[model samples]
Every structure is written in structure tokens, then in C-alpha cells.
Target chain A: MAAPAILITAFVVIGGMATALAQSLGLFPLVGPPSLTVAAYAAQASDLPVGIGLSLAIAAASTVVACLVGFTAALVIVQGRWCGKLVAALGTLTVPVPHIVGAASVSLLLADSGLLARLFNAGGSWPELVGGPWWIGVVAEYGWKESAFVALVVTGTLATRAVSYDETAALLGAGRLSRLRHVLLPLSLPTLTVSATIIFVYSLGSYEVAWLLGRAYPEPLPVMALRLFNAATLTARPEAAAVAIVTTLLSFGAVAAALAYLRRSTLWR
Target chain B: MIPAVRVEGLSKSFPGTGAPVLDDVNLTVEARSCTALLGPSGAGKSTLLRAISGLERPDAGRVLVGGQDMAGVGPEHRGMAMVQQRPLLFPHLNVLDNVAFAGTVRGVAKRAARADAAGFLELVQLAGFGPRPVAALSGGQAQRVAIARALAARPAVLLLDEPFSALDPELRSVMHDLLAQLRRSVNPTVLMVTHDRSEAAAVAEKIALFSGGRMLQHDSVERMYSRPVSLEASRLMGGANEIPGTVRNGCHHSALGALRLPGDTTWPPGPGILLVRQESIEVGPGNGPGLHATVSGLRVLGPRRLVSVDAAGVLLRAEIPWGRALAAGDTVTLSIPTSALAVVDDPDTAHTFPGAEKRPQITVQGLATLASIDN
Candidate 1:
């Protein structure tokens, strides 16, 4: 039963990638005889470096912020009183909202003349948060949306075995801080790492949030690829495929590193 | 010196329960003593242990360690350590680090704490096993490490909750001996909870019997066996036969026949329960001049034979040497010495022999009358 699904998925993904690779190597030209060349990679060499750096910075920042907030939310949901239920409900509510809708909502909320700035009557001095040089609005959109995902996954991990382990630590003479440091943190590390990897790869490849909230000078890799893929000139298509291939490789590398780290964790066994 | 631990008037009830799980319970353990809380499942033995260890807060009473009330104190601040049924070792840490955890939490240097932990491992006979991962240890070895971890804290009191229930019988015996040796060398006041009476008797100096959320009796192991205070306590302490009888003029009359009571007996003329240990009864040929009984069943248990006999219409169980060629359908004579009988007022009519048709109906008034006979 699973074999058919696996085969279909693998075929679609690998077929799509093979087509992109052929176009990226100048072997599947739209208007001329196909010839293998590295011109597509050379054409975007200057801007590709900038796009990669900007993408890494944004994904890394968003993932770090999301993980910190999400982990705290998970702890609260697992160990807290009445307020924990409220936080858990809010996280569940946030998870199903599409990223495109999230980006539009963030754009409306954080733009210079948006609701908050208008409410405070500080439109002239709203700090340029939306479409700013630092891409704060883009990072905030990803962080807000992905934090909920992290929280739900982590809550599931902790709900299984954390209470008994925490009680054992308490009986073993571990105080609140000691229990958190020795038991909860170490036990949650593998799940946290896995969730963080998902968040990093998701933010790296996502297009709508960055395009909706980011400045034009240093576009993220996904936005840059989309722009090149839609250009009027036909030669830019191969460059777009080249950028997509690089982004896929980076995401794969991150997932591999995370899996290796998870294997080495004592909690994995 | 002050007692190592004291629990006074402890009572706790869950939200939906009608009666309290722990009801006005009190217990004490002297310095350098080992006490076992013995009871059946759901008898609140473990709840009492947790309440004393500061893991559960009592509604009406307080726990005292070294005469210091532990109200509002956390388990860590109460200077007590507990070993649970599962070893509960922190899986992220090696055996040495897990054993050294309490010391490190108390702010001892890691190196010194590890050295102390090594000594504890040696005490548990796992000397070179310090660096092994906790997952690699067998069930018995993991529990041994748990004991070492509890001891490494040098706690004022130690609590164990059925710590050996998961091990095999042979490993359980080995753990019992290890605990006994550790008690001699370290001398920490210990309270262990177990449903197995033999396990409690083997490891503890004193045993506290509990049933239905109430402590029935607390006494030395010898006294708990030879002189249980109540019929319920007598049954819990392994009394196999209960004979209902009436006391009259310094003699006790029962289905087993009239027997002279001890001269010091204070039991007034009243209905009471006579408890007989299974081993105290001897079986012989039915032709002898004694209580004539027909063998109902015989079970060979290692070096002994458990023989069940029916005397007249009363069923009695006896344990005899395996050399006796006894089988079902054989006629036998049973002998019971009066000195081996422990008589007390029948607490309730819940348990009684089948042939005793004239047994008195238990009433509140009758219980009160029997209670007065003791004074």
C-alpha cells in the first residue's frame, strides 16, 4: 500500500528536479538548440551570494526566535495551570492559518500607516518595520506562524513522559531550576532540534512572507528566484532554476546535520 | 535523640473520593532504624510514604524530620531521598552522574560528588559499573544503582516504594541482603512500602500493617508475627486459620475443643477470635486419640507439604514435613497446642469458618462490649 504512494511522490519530486537541473545546466533552452553550459550559474554569481547570505540570516533569526518562544510555550502547556490551556488553545488556533494569509495580516498590522501607527498617531515615526532594511516584518511573520508549529510538536513530545521524569527528579532532590536544567531541557533537546530544523528549512524556501514584507535591495533567495523565473527575458529561466537548486541543497544539508545530531543525543535511544 | 522521622494526624482525600485516602495516620521511625509499610494494593501505603517525603501535601497534618516540621518545604529541602518501583535513573546521564545527581544539586563539586558516588556503587556491589549507561543495566542492576543514588545523598531519611517488585525472586533476595548490609554500614532511617509481607519482614526491623486507609498495627517483626493486636492484623501477619470461640472461666471453647487459656489472659467472658498459624498444626494417623480429620487436599511445596483437612465440617490448613505420605481422601488426626493460639475480639463477621453455625452476629453494641473487655 505504501509503496505506490512512495513511488508517486518520489517520481514527481525527482522528475521536477531533473527538469530544473536540465534547464539550469543550459541543456533545455526554450528558443534554441539545447547545449550544456555553466552560464546560468555564472549569470547570477554576483547577486546569488547576496541572496544566499540574506536568506540564511533571515531563516536563522526567525528559527531562533520561534524556537525560544515555542519551547517556553510548550513548557507552559505541559506544566502550567489555567493559563497553560489558554496558550495551548491559541497555539492550536494559529497553526491552521495559511502562511499567505499570515503575511497579509502582518503587512496590515506592521506597515508604517497601519492600524497601530494610526492608532498611536505616529505614522511618521513608526520605525519602518514593514518592508524595512532589516526585514523585521518578514522575520516576525515567519516567527509568529512557525512558533505555533514548534509549540504543538514539542507539547506532544513532552506530554508523553515529562511528568514522571519531572516527579522523579523532584524526589531525587532536584529543585525547580535543577529539574528544568537537568531533566526537562535535556529530555526535550531532540524534539527541539528536529522542530528547529523544520522551521529553518521552511523559512528558507518560503516566498510569500518575505516578498510581502521585505525591501527590494537584498531579496531572499526564494523571492529572487521567483523574480527571475517571471522576468520578460527568456535567459533568466535557467538562472531561476539554478537558484532553486541551491536552496534545495542548503535545506537538505541542514536536515542531514540535524538528523546526525539527533542520532548522537542520549534521549534518542 | 530525636526520632529520625515523625508523621502526625496526616489526612488526604482526592476531589471525588468520599473517604480520605490517608486518614489521621501517624508514624515514627527512630534513628538508624528500618520500618516497612506493609499492605495490599490500593491500601494507601504508598500515599503515606509520599506524604512523609513531602511529595504530597497532607490536608490536616505535618511531617517532621529530626523534630523539624516539614510544612511548606519541598522534597529537595526536606533532606529525604526516595527509590521508586522503577529505577527512574536520568537516561541522559551515565550511572556515576545519575548517582552523583543529588550531591551536585546540593552544590558539591562534581569531582567530589563522583568520588562519593563511587563509594555508594561499591556498597551496592556495582563497583566498576559506574561509567555504564543507565539503559544498559538490567532491571536488578538498575535498582541497585537507584539505591546507590539514594544513599549518595546522605539523606536524613530514605523512602522506598516497592523497589524490588519488578525483579525476579532470586534478584529480590539479593537486593534484600544488599539493603540489610547497607543499613548496618550507613544507618540512615529508612521507610519502605511493599505489598509483600515476607519482603517487608526480610528487610525491615519493624513492620506497619495498613488496610482500607487505616494503620492496623505497628510493631516489631517478631511481635507482629507472634502477637498481632487485632484479628485483621493477625490475618495480615499470615495467620492462616481463624477459629471463633467464647471465653469462659479462664478457658476458651471452640470447634477445635476446649483449651486452657494462659494464666495471664485478661480476655473476659465474651466471644473472640482464635488465630492459629498453619505450621503450628501437626497431622498424624486418624486412629490416634485427637481431633479426627479427613485429608481434603495435599500440595507439595519444596521441603514442606501443605495439607488441608476437614475436621467434622470445619476446614483447617496445616503445613507438615514432606516426608509424611499424605494424600487426598486419607483420614488424619490434627493436633494444635493452646500456646500457639492468639485470641482477640472478632472485629467483624466478614470472615468466619463454614461449620461454626452458632457464631454470634457482630453488632456495634457487641463490638463495643468486646472493646470494653480489653480494658
Candidate 2:
């Protein structure tokens, strides 16, 4: 690679690590006195388990749902005529939006006073269009967004994969569903994992969605940290910094572990 | 038993393509017979093979597995297996899962699928490779695994789209032997598409030549090569020496000299082109019972030699044995035997086909298999 590209990449990596370290050290002057201390760590440690649990539920559920839907969409597009074109046309529209934008859009569309409700009201419908607590939105958003992302990813990844296997599997007496379940799904899994993990990590650190559409109480990790930083006392800033560090570290850990597991699993070999 | 397959008027126009790649292609592949689709690069051989496997939808036509029309049958419903030119094994699956893929998808228990898949692995001569990663396989081994995977489903029809084109000649020959074994033992009907006439001739019981969006001819391998119905079929089958001749008194007089066609007595004297296979011309000395010619150059094809000679005024290529080496200036007698000539109305050639009078001193060697003769 050219020096500029390498330098740019290195700078991004260093910049991310530096910011993570600064946050962990409570260096921000706006909310608290800047210092490296173990007090923040101690205070946040009490809340870590719940936060981690919430993160896992959201991330894992989203990854699995996204992969199933995405891999299936990829198989259909690659194996089907009209459906493939339609999938291609609807690709990647929702994934790359800035976190704040994504969070706001989902909130506007699914919140009680949102467009969905307005549409329901216009129809004189009684049942709320999108209801329930954070769990519902967590599952619903991840399911909706990640599937499309996975679909796009799988399509690109499997472009070189042969259409002939469909034929061969058929010639071998495989029925339509069986061929997909047997030949197509298994074949697309490696790429499925890669794409799922990418969206998983995206979900892991995602703050905007949780802030906009997530429940106000029993706050998500990002929201919890945000509330701590906003406290009047300077003492709470270190604790908030500590929570941010832990959340960032958890995201890194999940991605790194998935990468390692993928390497050892013969998926890439 | 029902014939292995029957196809009629198969035609496909790719989305956005103005011309149909495959048009009105009719065929019957009998049970356990090996049939080859032969044509040049753009002759729609691949499209035809894909259509049979139900991988590609034809704009018009019918594909019958037995007596049933399979117009809307998807590939997975066709009970057929296909091998593409490049081996496209699932990178995510190990050899065991890759070969057993279809069976498992059909709800075969994993253990049973793996076991039956192992049997096919043995059939393709890769018995112990069940655990190997796809990337770890050699080119030849990967191709064999693809075959194993396809055959494991036990589909009655097997389609190969230039599958062996990437293999070295030696490996291709090995594949041929393996296919012959399948014909005898497994007894699957085979339909293969190839640009290589030599490979088609070697393995196929029947050959169908396609050109200009139509099947020029489909017949036994020998008949297709020796008695190609048109100039296109002849050209695709390695008849590079062509000459425009005038039919006079039921005898065609050409730049390659004169010859008689039994079927030409009814045609009025006008213009026609004579196609001569390279092997038809025997090169010797003197104008004794042949077209007068001179040695131009020669190419040595492994066991045989192709002697380039000038017959009359036209440059033509003829295959000769490697036993003797002729220099560039030697006077050579070129024979234009009646059986060696195919005449057609000169179509689209206006340079008076120097092919008749313009002799380029060139010889082709190494490609000297006569398997295409005597259908």
C-alpha cells in the first residue's frame, strides 16, 4: 500500500485506542476532574453484569436473526430470477445511516406517536402498531436492520459461487427446499458468520438507537454511561468514563473472539 | 425404461440480450448414453447444458425427464447434477459435508449422508479426502469432489459444462476413463458441453454441433465430424482449409483442384466453397492423381505432423506422419479425394477465398486424433 493509505489506517487505529484510553482515565474536563483512578472502576463494576447481559441478548439475537434472514435472502436472489432483482434493488438502504439518524428514524417509525401509529389511527385501528419495552424494540430493530445488511453482504460474497450446484443438487434428486437447506445454506454460512459478526459489533456499541427508541428506565450501557457523565458532581465522571471503557472493551472482545473462532473453525481454511 | 432425457425447441434469450443464445435446440439423450454438445465459444453450448439441468430458464421449449414436461421445474427439482468448468465447492464445508450436501439437505441424517457421501468419494477416486478443507484440495481433486457431490444425490442426468477444460490433457484423459466407468457401472445419462471437439469425440457416444443460434447437426460423433451438414459445422470441427469452387457438370472445380460430389449433380453450375479436413490431403511429389502442390512449412504435433502445402494456387493445411521431414521448398503432390470434399454455396466470403488459391505454408501437428472419423 502507499504510505498515505498505510499512515491513514494507522492513524485511525491509534486514534481509536487513544480515545478509549482517555475515556477510561477520566480525562474529560467538562464533567469531572481529570484523573486516572480505580474509584470509577469500582462504582461501575456493580452494574457490569446487567449491562453485559443486555448487550449479549441484543447482539446475539440480532446476529442469529440477521444471518438466517440474510443467508436465505442471498440464496433466493442467487437462485431465483425475479426475487433476485427485487432484493438487489432494495439493498443496503438502512444499514449505513449515521447512528443518530438510524435511532431517530426507527423511533419516528415505531414509537407510540410515530408514523406507524398515525397510519393505524388513519385506519381507525385500536391496537398500537409498535408496542412493548426495550426488549421488543431491541429484537425488532436488530431483526429488521441486520437481515437486509446480511442479505447485501451475502450476495456480494457469494457472487462467484456457482449456480451449477443448484443444478447438480437437483440432478442428484434434491427437491427445491432441500437443495437450499442442504446445498445453499451450508455453503453461505462462512460469509454469513462474517457479516453477522460485523453487524453484531455494530449493535454492541450502538448508542443512538438505544437512546431514541430504548426504554428510559433500566437504561442500556451507553445510556447509563451518558447519564453518569451528565451528573452534577465531578466525582461521577470517572465512573462514567469507566463504564465507557468497559463497554468499548467488551465490543472489542466479542469481535476478536469471533474472529479467532472463525479462523479455527475451518470456515476460512 | 424411459429415455434418460428428451428436449425440444429449447431457446433462451438472456435478459437484455437481443439475440437468443440457444434457439430451438432439439435433443434426445437415451438412458446411460453419453452425449456431447459441440460448438465454438458463442454457439450456446453452455446455455443448452444449463437449460437441461434447469439452472437456466428457456424462453421457449420443453425439457422432459421421462415423459413429463418440466417447463417450470427448478434446478433443485430436476434431480440432475452439473459440473461447471471451474470447481465451485462450498468453501465453508469440509469435503465430507460438501459431498454429502444434497443428501443432508434432503433430510438425510448427517451420519448417513456422510457415509453415503464417502462412497461417492471413492467413486471419484478420493476415498480418504472426506475431511479435507476445500482450499486444501488440488485442482484435479476439487473437480473430483464436485463430481462426487453431484453424483451422491444419484440424479439420473449429469450435466458437464466444459468441466474438464481446465484440466491438463493427462488429467482430462483420466476424467474420460472415469466417465466411461460411470456409464458402465453407475449408468447415469451424461450430457456435456464442450468447445473442444477432440474431447467430445473421445468421450461422447453422440455429438451435437450448434452455430448461429441453431443446432447445425446432432448425430453420432463420427457422423457430425465426417458429414457436417453445413460450412459452420465443418469449420467448428477443424476444417480450416476451405476453397470456393465452381460446380461444373456435377464436378466441383476449385483452387484445391477438382473433385466430384455424388449429391451435387442437381445443382446448377455457379459458386460453391469446398471444405477439406487437414488430414484428407496426402503430400507427395509430382501431379500424380492429386492436386499439384509445394511444401510450405510444417508443424510437429507430438506423434503426428501437419504439412502445409500449396495446392494449385491456394494455401491449404494437411496432416502427414512425422516419419519424414519435408523442407519448405519441396514440390508436393496434394490429393483431393472425392470423399474428402464438402461443398457449400460460398456465403459471406468475397476475397474469392484465397483459401482456394492462396496457400500459406503452415502445418498443424500434435492434434492428430482420428476418433472423429467413421461414425
Candidate 3:
């Protein structure tokens, strides 16, 4: 029974990748005889580097911020206090909101003429956060959505055996800061790494959030790929496929590195 | 010297429970001495330990260390260490680092802390186990490491919660000997909680008996065994053959017949329970002058035989040498010496005499054999 599902998933995923590879190598021509060439990859050499750099910067920044806030939230939730329950409930509520919707909401909150600027009466004086040179709104959307995911996963890791270990540490003369440094942080590392890698890969490949809140020039890789795929000129399709393949490779690299680190962590046992 | 640890009027209760788990508990541990908190499960012995360690805050009480009140003190600042039933060594650290943790938290240099931890490991007979992962250790070895880790802190008070209860019988004996030897050199004020009376007797100078969240008695181990405060306390310390009777004119009258009381008997004439150790009962042929009983059971236990007898509908237990060769249905005369009798006023056991209602039979044959093996 499982074989059918596995075969179908493998066929769709590998078939899609094969189609994209063929297109990127100049085959599957829409208006001419199919042929093989590296011109599609070579065409975007100048623009591809900028897109990749921007994509990596946004993903890395978003992942770091998400992990810090999410890990703190997890600690609070596992403490089993009233305010901790409230924070946990808010995180649960935030997790289900679509990224595109979160991007729209963030734009309404942080745009120069948006609600925050109106409430503060600092219109025209508010920092350029949405569609600005920095892509603050795009990073904020990804961070807000993915932080909840990280918090939920980390809370699970702590719920199992953290209490007994914490008590033992306390009895062994560890203060609050010492317990966190020695016990909580090391115990939570493997889970935090896995969650951060997921956030990085998701932010790198997601197009809708960046298109909704990003600038037209110097776009993130996903936004650049979408623009090229939708261009009136038919030849830009192969360049879009090349960008998508590069994004996939980067995500794979990040996941592999995280797994290697997890294998070496003492707490992984 | 001031008592190393003192607790006064400690009381705690959980939500939805009408009774407190620890009720007005007061205890003191002399400096450089070991006291065992002996009780059955759910008797709040472990709770008292946690309260003294500052892991649980009592609703009402005060804990003092070295004659100083610890009102606002935290566990880390109280200069106390605890060993739990499970080793609970941190999985993220090796044995050496886990042992050195308290030193690191106190801001000791890493090299010095490790050196001190190594010395402690040697003390616990795990000299070369410093660099091994905690996961690789057996149950006994892990528990030894836990003891070493707790000692590395050099605490003024050491609290252990049934630390050896998880080991095999042989390992448990080894740990008891190791602990006794360590006490001579490290000599921290130790309060160990265990349900096993023999373990307490082996390792503790004083024993505090607890039941139903109330402290029954606290005295030296020898006194606690010889003169238990009540019949329940006597049974807890392995006292057998409790005979309910009445005291009258320097003699006790019961189903076993009137017997001369000890000259030091001070009880005014009334109903009481007489306690006799199983080893104190002497058996002879049916021709002797004593209460006549028929042997109902004979169990050959290594060097001795446990003989069960029925005397005029009263059941009694006696231990004799294996050479007696008595069999079931043999008539014998049992004599309990007057000096060996300890009368107790236990209201709970007043109507629990062998012939009154139904005697609560205790199956301690296996326990006796285990105790003998330990010796």
C-alpha cells in the first residue's frame, strides 16, 4: 500500500526536476526544434549572482531572528505559567496564517502610510520598511511566520525530560544562568538547528511573500525567477528554471550541513 | 559544634488534598553524621528531603544550616547536594564534566575542577571512568558516578533519595560499604531516605522513622531496634511475635499463660502488647515446663530453621538452629525469656493479637534470608 504512494510522489518530484533540468539545458523549446546548450544558464550570469546573494541574506537574517525569538518563547511555554500559556496560544494562532497573508498584514503595519505610521502620526517620516532598499517587510513576514513553527518544535523537545534535568542541575548548585548555559541550551540545540534549517529553506524558495512586499529592482531569487518566468519573451523560461535549480541546491546544502552538526552534538543521544 | 542541618515545624500540602504531606516535621542532623529517614512509600520522607534542600518550599517552616536560618536562600546558595534514585547525570557531558559541573558553576578554573572531580571518582572506585559518556555506564557504575559528582561539590549537607534502590542485591551491598568508607574521609552531614530498614541500620548512626506524614520516632539505630516507641514502629524495624496481653502484679497474662515480667517493668496494670524477637524464643521437647505448642510449619533456612507453632489457638513464630530437626505435628514447649520482652502501647495493634480477630500475618522469611546474606 505504501509503495504506491511512494512511487507516485517520487514520479512527480523526480519528473518535475527532470523537466526543469531539460529546459535549463536549452531543450523543450516552445517555438523551435529542441536543442541542448548552456546559453540559458550563461544568460543570467550577471543577474543570477545578485539574486542569489539577496536571497541568502534574507534567508540567513530571517532564520537567525526566528531562532532567537522562538527559542525564548519555547522556554516560556514549557515553564507552565499563565503568561507562558498566553504566549504559547499566540504562537499557535500565528502558525496557521498563510505567508502571503502575513506579508500583506506586515505591509499594512509597517508601510510609510500604514497603520503604525498613522497611529504614530509620523507619515513621510516613518522609515522606508516596505518595498524599501532593505527588504525589511519581506524578512519580517518570513520571520513572523516561521518563528511560530520553531517555537512549537522546540517546545516539544523540552517537554520530554527537561524538568528532571533542570532539578538535578539546581541541586548540583547551578543558578538560573548556569542551568540555562549548561543544560537548556545544549539540550535544545539539535531541535533548534533542524527548525532553523527548515525556516531558511522555506524563506529561500517562497515567491509570493517577497513579490507582495519586495522592491522591483534587486529582487530575491524567488521573486527574480517569477518575474523571468512571466516575461513576455519566451526565452526567459529556461533562465527561471536555472534559478529554481540553484535555490534547490542551496536548500539541500543547508539541510546536509545541519544533519552533520546534529550527528556530532553530544545531546543528540 | 552546631548541627550541620536543622528543620523546624516543616509542613506542606498539595492542591485538593486536605492533609499535609509533611506535618510539623522537626529534625536535626549532627555535624559529620549520617541519619537515615526510614519509612514506607508515600510517607513524605522524600518530600522532607526536598524541602530541606530548597527544591520544594514548605508552606510553613524554617530550615537552618550551620545554625543560620535559610529563609530566602535558594538551592544553589544553600551549600547542599542531592543524589536521586536515578543517576540523572547530564547526557550532554562526559562523566568528568558532569562531576566538575558544580565547580564550574562556582567559577572554579576548568583544570582545577577536573582534577578535583578525578579525586572524587577515585573515592567512589571509578578512578578511570572520568572520560566515559554517561550513557555507556551500567546502573551501578552510574550511581557511583552520581555519588562522586555530588561529593565533588563539597557540600555541607548531602541528601540522598534511595540512591541504591535501583541496583542489584550484590551491587547494593557494595555501594553500602563504599558509602561507609567514604563517610570517614569526606564526612558531610548526610540524610539518606530509604524504605529498607536493613540498609538504614547498615549505614546510618541515627534513624528517623516516618509513617503517614508524621514522624514516629528519631533515635540511634541500636535504640530504635531494641526499644521501638510503638508496636507499629517495632514491626517497621522487623520486630516479630507481638503478643497482646494484660499486665498484673509483676506478671503478664495472655494466651501463652502468665509469665514473669522484667523487674524494671513500670507500666501500671492494664492491657498492653508484648514484643519478642524471633531469635529470643527457645524450643525444647514436650517434657519441659512451659507453654505447649504444636509445630505447624518448619522452614529450613541455611544455618537456622524458622518454626511456626500454634499454642491454644495462638500462632507464634520462632527461629531455632537447623540441628533441632523438628517436623510438623511435633509437640514442643516454647519459652520466651522475661528479659527479652518489650511491651509497647500501640492502639493499632491492640485487637490484632493472634487469637483476636485475624492477625495481620507478615511474610518476612525472604527478607530475613536476604539480611543474613548481607552479613
Candidate 4:
């Protein structure tokens, strides 16, 4: 029943990757004769290390922040209180907003001379959050948006069966903290792992959020690739393809590592 | 000694529901004794058990455990353990670790708790089954592990919410035997909620009957079956026949004919219901000197046959041993001793009694033999 969707996804991803790989090898260049060479990859040697490290750091930070916040949100929501209902509503509302819109909203809220700076009356003293050295604004956008996704998925799995087990544990003399440590954490681990992997891969490959909120010196892979692809010099196209291919390989590597870890986890079953 | 658990004037009502889920309930379970909360679905039996365990807070009531008021105590501090119908074993833990959960939560070392848990596993007859993941256990084994885990806590009170109802019949019987063994060894004060009358009668010393959130009667298991307080209570306890009639002097005049009531029956002369258990009625050939009855229907129920007889215009059911051969339409005589007769106030013309009705214990040979046969 799902064969068609899976086939279409596979075809698009594989075909696009093949085209990028061919271009990175200096074949089918936009303004030059078709020729095979490693010149584009060699040209990117200077900037590739910085871009890769920045991208990995951003993705890792975002995934960690999202998982922690999302797990807490899910625990609160499953508690079935009025505040839990409010958190659930907030998560539901946040999931549908595009990452770009979230990035814009975050920049408006955290930037120097932005809403927060005016509200706190710290115009001159406000930290450089937006386009900052730490990439705070960029990571915040992805973390805030992706945490909602993680919360909803994890809440779905916990709401069904966790309550009974929790009650049973409590009846067996488990206190609140003990129950959270033994019951909730172990129960939510598998879902948290899966959502974390998804967030990491997504933040690693997405461009617009980082481009709008990041500095220009040590740009993330997606932002660097987009800038190189749009540069006026035609030779930069293959280098852009090379960066894009590297990003794809990193995402694939993250997914493969997650799957391997899940396969070995006793609770994942 | 003070009762192990005491509930007084307990009541609860959920919002948007017309009737209360539990209404002014009171009960007492003695230390080291087992009591079965017997009722139908939605009878608030489980609600009462949860309220006692501190899992549920009653709108207006006081739960006292071992003479200490448990008003603000949480479920963890109540020293109670509950085994639900589904087991709810921690899937992430192995069988040994699951059983050791209570001790570990109390800050005991893992190796020491597991060592103590090994003994509990042996009590439930699953000694070597430890070290296996909970997923590897069958339904019966899982439930046994749940019971073992609860027992490992050494709780002051154990609450069971239809723990065996989810298992197959044969497995349920095996679990009943395991409970009997546990009772002999641990002697934990127990309150179990179940809709299965037989299960209640088999495991509990006292039976508390509930209906529509009200406790009808609380008495010994023998009395609950042989002398129920009301027609509803009798029916709930698996009473097969209710002969509606009037009581005058000491005799109940009904369609089955006038029968002398037991000497200690407190029922005043008024409308009454004569409750006769099916097994209490003895059937023989027509030559016997008893009420004449024609066997109208015969049903094969396992090793026993349910014999439906028409005695004059009144019908009665009698369970006979399958070894005796008697088909439908056979002329038979049913002899019921006057001592076996019990009369309760008829709801139409009198107020039904809600308190425990204690009658003199009368052991009929057939009732004893039937119980033994079942065992």
C-alpha cells in the first residue's frame, strides 16, 4: 500500500544525489565543457572543515536542547493537569509554523534592539543573540520548533500505557522522582532517540533558518552551500554541489548510526 | 486487634455523571485476613479498593491503615501494593529486576534487593524463570511475576483488582491455587475485587457485596452464599431460585408450599422471598416422600448436570452429579430441609435490609460434598 510513496521518495533522493555527485566531479558544469575532475572538491579544502564543524555543532546542540525540553513537556502533558493542557496546546500550535517563520520570529524576539531588548530596557547591553558568534538565534529556532514535534510524538506513546505502569509503580512504593527515573525515563528513551535523530538530520541540512540568523565567517554547511550555489562565479557551482553532497552523506551517516543503536537497544522493541 | 484497614462513610462522584460512583461505603478488613469485594461491573468495587490503597481520593471519607489515619498519605507511603488485571510489569527490566523494583525504589542496593527477590520468585513457583526478560513470559507467568513483585514489597496490605480475570479458565484455576499457597505462607492482609463469585468464595474468608456503589452486605463467605440478606444479594451470589411469597408466624407460604424458616431469622411477619440454592435442592425418584417435581430440562455443565424441575406450578433448578442418569421429563421428588430455608424481605412490600444478616450456620451434606467435589 505504501510502495508508491516509498518508491517516489527513493527515486527523487537517489536521482538528485546522483546529479549533485556528477556536478561535484566537474562533469555537466553550467558554463564549461563536460569534463571529469576532482578540482571542485580540491577547491573547497580551505572552507570545508569550518563549515562541517559548525554544522555538526549546531545540529548536536539543537538536538540536545530539543530532546531535553520535549521530554519534560511530554511528562507534563501526560500528567493531565490544566498546565499540561496548556503545554499540549502550545506544542500543537508550534508544530505547524514553518522553520523560516520561526527563525524570523526568534530574531525579532532576541536580536539587539529587538522586542526583548526593548522590553527589558537593555538596548545597549543586550547580548548579540541574533547573528551572534554562538549561533544562539539559529539553534533556538530549530530547538523551539523541533521540540514540539518531539513532544507530540513522545506524548502519544506515553499517554496510552505509561499511566497504568506509573500507578502500579506508585502503589509499589515508588516516589515521584523514583517513578520518573525508573518508569518515565526508560519508557520515553526509544521515542526520544528517534525524535533526536530526526531533529539532528533536519537541522543539519536546512538552509534558510541558519542563513537568516547566522554570522557570515564560519557559516554552517547548508548556508555555505546556498551562498556558493548563488555566487556569480560559475566555477563555484561544483564546489556548492560538493558541499551539498557532503551534507547529504552526514545526514545519511547520522540515520545509519541511529538505526544501529536502536537495533541494539533492549527497550526499542 | 484493630482492623488492618478501615474505611468509614466513603463517597465519591465524578463530574458530569448523574449518580455517584461510590456512595457512603464502609468496610473493615481484619489483620491477616482476606476479604473479597464482590460485585458486578460498575459496582464500584475497584473504586473502593483503589480508595483504600490511596490510589484514589474519596470525596468524603477516611481510610485508616493499622489505626493510623491515612488522610494525606500518598500511595507510596501507604505501605500497600496493587496488582492490576494486566500485570503492568516493567518491560525494560528482566523478571528478577522487576521483582526487585520495590526495594530498589526504597534505596536498597540492587544486588541485595535482587537477592531478596529471588525468594519471592520461588514462592510464586517461578524461581529459575528470573533473568528472562518480561517479554518472554506468557500471560500466566507475567501475572505470577506481578504477584511475586507485589509480595516482595512485604506490604502491610495487598490490593488485587481482578488480577486473574484476564487469564484463561485453566490458568485462573492455577492462579487460585497459587494464591491459596501464598495465603498459607505470607498471610498478608488482602482485599480483592472481582465479579466472579466463585473466585471470591474460593479465596476470601469474608465477602463484601456491592451494587450500584452501595455495599449490600458484608459477612462470611458461607453466610453470603447460604443466607443472603436481600433478593439482589442472593442473585448476585449465584442464587438460582427466588420464590416470592409472604411470611406469617415462622413459616414462608410460597408456590413451593409452606416451609418453616430457620429458628434465628429476624424477619417479621410480612412479604418475603425464599432463597434456595440450586445445590441445596436434593432430587430423587418419584417413590421418595417429598415434593413431587417433573424434570423439565437437563443441561450438561461440565461434571455436573443442572436439572430444571417443575414442582407443581413452580420451577426450580438442582445441580446433580453427572454420575446419576436422569433425562428431561423424568418424574422426580425434591427434598429441602426446613433448616435450609432462608427468607428475606420482599422489595415490593418491605424495606430490603442493607446490613449483614447473620443466620445460624447449617451445613447441608450436599453443600459440603459439592464444595469438596469442586476442590
lDDT of 4 by residue, B91-176 (tens): 88999999999999999999999999999999999999889999999999999999999999888898999999999999999999
Steric overlap count per candidate: 0, 18, 0, 0
Task: Return the TM-score for each candidate structure.
Answer: 0.92, 0.83, 0.91, 0.93
Candidate 1: where are CA atoms >4 Å away?
A: A118-123, B1-3, B261-265, B285-292, B329-331, B347-375
Q: How would the candidate models be sorted by DockQ, starting from the highest?
A: 3, 4, 1, 2
Best prediction by lDDT: 4
Docking class of 1: medium
Q: Model 3 in CAPRI terms: which quality?
A: high
Tell me the TM-score of model 4: 0.93
lDDT per residue (tens digit) for residues A32-64 in model 1:
999999899999999998999999999999999
> Distance (Å) between predicted and true CA of A209, model 4?
1.2
- Tell me the spans in candidate 4 whose CA falls farther than 4 Å from its real position: A33-36, B1-3, B349-375
What's the DockQ of model 3? 0.82
Error of 1 at B335 (Å): 3.4
> What order do candidates take by lDDT, descending?
4, 3, 1, 2
iRMS per model in Å: 1.2, 2.8, 0.9, 0.8
Winner of 2 and 4 under TM-score:
4
**Which candidate, 1 or 2, has the higher DockQ?**
1
Q: Give the TM-score of candidate 1.
A: 0.92
Better of 2 and 3 by lDDT: 3
Clashes of 3: 0
